[model samples]
Target: MQKYTVLLLINFFLLLANYSSAAANDSFTLGVIADCQYAEQANKGTRYYTSCPDKLSTAVEQFNTLPLSGVLHLGDFIDRDFQNFTVLNTISSVLNTPLYHVLGNHEFSIDDSLKMRVPETLHMPARYYSFEINNWLFIALDGNDVSTYGWPKTSKRHKRNIALFNTKYKGHEDWNGAIGAKQLKWLERKLNTAQTQKQPVVLLSHFPIYPENNHNLWNAQEVLTLISQYSTVKAWFNGHNHVGNYAQKDGVHFVTFHAMLDTDSTAFSTIEFSPNQLVINGQGRQPSMVLPIN
Candidate 1:
């Protein structure tokens, strides 16, 4: 009987040790919401344009209760009218966690005069930037950097991108944009730094670079080629394909989050990251996923 008691105590202590080890890991959670696309306009097809403010409020309220390191909104905060940002801003202001933004093409769907003001309007440090949490590097890419809509009609980039789109991506939607040479080089440098430090990376973009979808980034292959070379890049999180998608390639998970503007359900997610895996706890229309890190 004494031997059995000792064995039981040893097992209990081992379990406690395991739990403590897990707790000590640099694990963290982040809230993710995509394509809120709020506007005062009426519903257009499946997009409940007017429902965004309330939906975002509900998501923010829920996030406030969670121990989130930050909350990332994967762009398209408004469907149109620049004034709509005011209403969305009010809703996002109450979030207790740090809010991060990624630029979406629709964010530029306003007067050309307001185009350059988008980064400032969204409170983004830059159109594309990087931040680190618990040794994990999160790189945010501005896919709209070389787009048709984000620039004035008379701008050289606008004309060049339009011409490029007409020539190569004629069958695909022109709404998609690419990471320009400068941004691509910058991304390479960031990736190199992460790799040297053995830090895992999570890329945030408004466009997906996988699965050959029409909603993919204009230079999807180029981005894909670059990312595939880096084993430190564990995942790519994106929006713009409101339907949502997931694909795994070269040990990297490509996740396209569902738009909050679609359906009545309202989509959002919280991702818990550990040393070994990611636990994606989805809310509403979003689906939960468990992705293991290699």
Candidate 2:
């Protein structure tokens, strides 16, 4: 009986050590691209709209060579033309892995009658939704939910957005936008569930929420406060500002990637998440950074 008990104890210790080592070795890489803003227009100021297709093709070729679990476009996949969506589709289809998209203001730049088709074109389940990948929750938000530029001028939501912009934001601009009340509630529920499940979260939005700027979401402060309530949120990724920015608050990392539209060169990155740290491997013009996970 003593010999059997000693063998059982040794087996249990060995299994425990193996589990620890496996957990430490677990990691996943995610491909990230933002503000592709593809269009067949001449260069306007800093944005080279006509050059995005070649840039996207290059990005897709690079991503295909990488061992990424999935790819996420932080939005502005096209500029202001509905025709550009077809070009985007052609360029992005070369990606061999799963691809996800978040809606940006440019998605609604078409006529109001065709605005509803944008989501379907991008293969998004909804304007705002959540998905799970390797024990992490990714939440994609629609910042254009209340934008004057995105919503139809005759619609009540557009009027409400204008009123809010005038009164609350002091008429910031039609380019800026906010998440609606329903979406806010949905986000809260998702965060609560993630907390209960002990899952880490990576939030994706088209508008910046931190390091306040003209391109930030209209209700950015509210969104920031809401996210800070949940400890499970590890990072927030965004675009819209185009210049790119980074900040950390209350244990969450806010990272904004540069717009692919700005230059003739490409801008994209792959992010690897490990047990202890998050590493961003930038390609083209995107800047790399290493962030420790809490």
**lDDT for each of the candidates?**
0.92, 0.90
TM-score list, all predictions: 0.92, 0.92
lDDT of 2 by residue, 1-294 (tens): 999999999999999999988875578898999999987878989899888888888888988998888999999998887888998898788889989999988888888877878888999999899998888999999999877787778888889978877887776767878988899999999999999999999999999989878899989999999999999999999988898999999999999999988977788999999877899988878999999999
* Candidate 2 segments exceeding 4 Å error: 1-17
Model 1: CA > 4 A from native: 1-23, 166-171
Error of 1 at 86 (Å): 1.0
User: In candidate 2, which residue pairs get closer than 3 Å at backbone N, Cα or C atoms, i.e. clash?
Assistant: none
As a whole number from 0 to 100, the lDDT of residue 166 in candidate 2 is 81
Tens-place lDDT digits, model 1, residues 1-294: 999999999999999999988765679999999999988887989999988888999999999999999999998999998999989998899888889999999999899988989999889999999999999999999999877688889888889878877886576676888888899999999999999999999999999999889899878998999999999999999999999999999999999999999979789999999988999999999999999999
* Candidate 2 local lDDT, residue 38: 82
